[model samples]
Target chain A: MKFMSNKTLKMSKVLLSAVLSVGIIASLSGCGSNESAKNSATPPADSAGSNLIVSQTNPIVIDKEAKTVKVYTEVNGKYFVEPTRHGVVFKDGSNGSKSVLKAWGNQNDFYNGLVDIGAKPGNNLKLDSVGVAVEGDPLDVSITWAGAGKEIPFGDGILDSTKKGFDFRFGGNQENAKAKNTGCILCLDSCPVGITSNAAHPTKDFDNKIAEFKGNQEVLPADGTPVVVTFKLK
Target chain B: MNTKQRKWLNVLGSGLLGFNFGFVAALLLAQWTWLELRVNTGLAILVGVGIGLGIGLLRTIKRPLAVESISLLAMLISLLGIGDAQISSLKILTGYTIREGLLMPDISLQVANLIFSLLTLGSILSAIVLKRKISG
Candidate 1:
């Protein structure tokens, strides 16, 4: 009986050790798999001027003749916008640009579904037209930031770009645009050009960091300070 | 130890092993699918029966009471594992920050858990009872 008990104890120890070994191996493999998955899904950052510049002090130029707004990104590099169809729109007069930035789906969906507007190789969003309004003086333009319900204003100032030699300029600091509490830096919506995401929906390659600069606080512009356009109002 | 106590120990060990295997399987499945495929009633039933049968065969316990008790414990543990795996999967698939995922409403998850729990219990009980009768 004593011998039989000893054998059973030995077997039990062997079984426990085997289970532990398998568990450890499984966990390690899981970590490895996750790391690979994350790496593969990360968006490429190799493009020239691959940084976003939020202009705090510069006014986004409105070209009424071209029916487009020249959105000045610090770097002409890649960028993305959400709700591909209606990326940038103007709030007609100061209702706070609220109607212009409606959520595409549930409000929560806005938090991570920012579409890439200009990050692909050879694919650049140099100029987007404002789809909602073609001609108007002092249009209230705004862009939707992820999850935030409020529109980031392009300052209370208004300019008519159609006027010959009417130098159109709007002002605000880049700090407000980059701040989590503040909305977008450039009110790209006032421009007559419409912007769209590269993809119909956000793919794994969509970089959340660009939308919500979580830990990285420094607002690094890819190019130099964004180009400032002087507009001659009609 | 007496034969009766040894049999109980065997049942306990088998149940623990079953739980571990089932948990691992559920976790792996969740990761592979990225939470798109949830642990539902059918999955729960499969995990419970597979674990119960594997334990019964491995332990070769003849006591009906021991078999039933172990099956119950194993099924419960497996359910917990499934729940945990699904939550983790949701966090990953939704792309939510860790804090957001954890705080998000889990009404659907709760409903799934209830269904899976019931299905697992029924399947495990049936497996244990059938095995006992066959052995007898």
Candidate 2:
């Protein structure tokens, strides 16, 4: 009986040690296996339907004293203020006006009006500054674009002289000029400029000539700035 | 061997077996459909109870009190092992901290706790009431 009991005690110790060793090995092995699985399973950053615009440059500058919003883009080795689409809506508490400026081509095409300097279109139409001369401190301001979608919220509407306007670049390096243009439709509702107004307001209407153009809409270009929208509250 | 030493050996063997079973069950639950991994309270409780009942039936203890105690201990040990495995799997698979994974509104930890408690109670009761087979 004594010999049998001694053997039993030895067996118990062996079993306990075996169980502990297996548990330790299992726990440590899990971390390494999990790491490898995670690396292999992650998906690409820009798989279809992922609306990621990769722009590294700041493009919009707001001049409060000058009451002007300036938008700039790199075109043909030069910085130009010409955007494929630009619009500004100005309201003072009660009423407002919405003005839309668009270049010729499908709304989704990014390179519609791009031309050389001293080109036939002239500088007046190519300039990036949209002037809104309104009286009584035009308390509310909303800006929109045709080729870009809403990527960030435009914080409170109040703009100070020191405040710089919002800047965004579309379609990073792969400048597919034919990328679909999903327009920003909530710019006014997201603006923090004026007191919350519930009254129905006028919407900016696109130019019939440009809107009617039945051209092949190409993807945005892969290099340089394709689409940029900047809002400067003055 | 003495009764105390034999009882302790039985407990240790049963507890370790229960832990291993629980860990594998948790891993299987984690690798199930994505939604199951996110909210596997029902599965965890079921696994805990099953392990406890299985371990209890395999032990030689016949007294109701001893059976209940062993089963309860095994259940607690297994549940703890399962919880650890679940947290590790969530971190490895989803890159989410255990807190982040469990804090989602849809995957309530409170619900899991309730299920675990109720199942553990049922398992303890079953162990005490179930008859053990007699071997000549």
Candidate 3:
């Protein structure tokens, strides 16, 4: 009996140390991941979407002061997401934002997976930072969003095999990305259907849309003609 | 130490941890989904019990637990907490857009709930329970 007990105790100690050592190593490795996989992403030498000064073309967008959804994320496979009852909250002084998944029915799993993927909260994404932009709402209310995946299918639930997509114009406004020119596109080639809003208060698009952009290309503007932008905000 | 005593310590400490984590996860999920019930309470209890028992198997443990064991638990809790917080936030933000009756980009809350409860937290919590049992 004594031998068994002593053996168990010794073995447990060794295993415990191994467990802790492994964790420390993992966290340390993550800190340096920001080292970047490629040369600093050159802002599209004119890849600027709107505001010219700041672009919302990237997967994630941030307003910094507003604590709201400038633009969110959508993976290709994810089908549905829940709505954010609280809306978005932003961390102050952040230069970037992560693409957010819409919190649908399975929020817990979605969230945990993200953290595993290194989604920074309180620093990058603050859930409790309820939209100060929206008044009379709970400050801590965490807003959940639904995820959209399949490419922009055409009306009647079929893929738009045509090159007709919307030519998006930037509200050109930097104050708040309120979508303007949401109507009337001069061209619609290889574009989806219409102008619609995405994670950003206004992910300019041709109407008849749903927010989905995983395993897909960046949403180009419609009309094949550059959507002239004019940054105007409140 | 007697095997029975080691077993009890492992089981009880791990059990408490499992219960506490489940409760916290539920709260966090609720916050993310903006729904009253992110994880069904009854279902959560069942999960918690199963986890507790599994950990209890590691119940024959060392005393006082160790630094490494505790650190691992902390890491898991921190990670899960952060994830839950994000999901809750997304739900709230998307709610407003949809309320305005606009179809927008959003991730599914149900999926988040499952991942958090069954996979992430569930795995770590179970692991910790066992760790504590063995350490004791």
Which residue window of length 10 is worst by lDDT in model 3 chain B? B96-105
Every prediction: chain A TM-score = 0.20, 0.19, 0.26
TM-score of chain B of 3: 0.39
Give one clash count per candidate, in the order shown: 28, 20, 98
TM-score each candidate: 0.24, 0.22, 0.27
- What proportion of the true contacts does each candidate reproduce? 0.00, 0.00, 0.08
Per residue, candidate 2 scores C-alpha lDDT tens digits across B1-136 of 5656555544543443343345335544543333331253224423543564466457754443343444334433543454454533222222111112233322222232233333334433333333222111
**Candidate 3, residue B109: CA error in Å?**
23
Local accuracy of candidate 3 as per-residue lDDT tens digits, A1-234: 979866755654675566445434443443233223212322221222433221223323222233322222222111112222111111111100111122111222222222332333212112132211111111111111111122232121112323232222211121121122111111111111111111221222212233222111123210011111111111
* Model 2 TM-score on chain A: 0.19
The segments of candidate 2 whose C-alpha lies over 4 angstroms from its true place after superposition are A1-234, B34-38, B41-46, B61-136
Off by over 4 Å in 1: A1-234, B1-27, B33-107
RMSD each, Å:
18.2, 22.1, 17.4
Task: Please give, for residues A1-234, the per-residue lDDT of candidate 1 as tens digits.
Answer: 979855644554454344334434433333333233222322122112324222322223333343333232221111110111122222121111111131112211111111111111112122232122212222233221222233433222111122111111122222222232223222322221122221211212112211110111122111112222112222
For residues A1-234, write the lDDT of model 2, one tens digit per residue: 979855644554454344344434543444444233223321112212324321323233333343333233211100011111122221110111111211111221221211111112111111122231111112223322223343223222212122333222111111221122222111221111211111112111111111111101122211122223332222
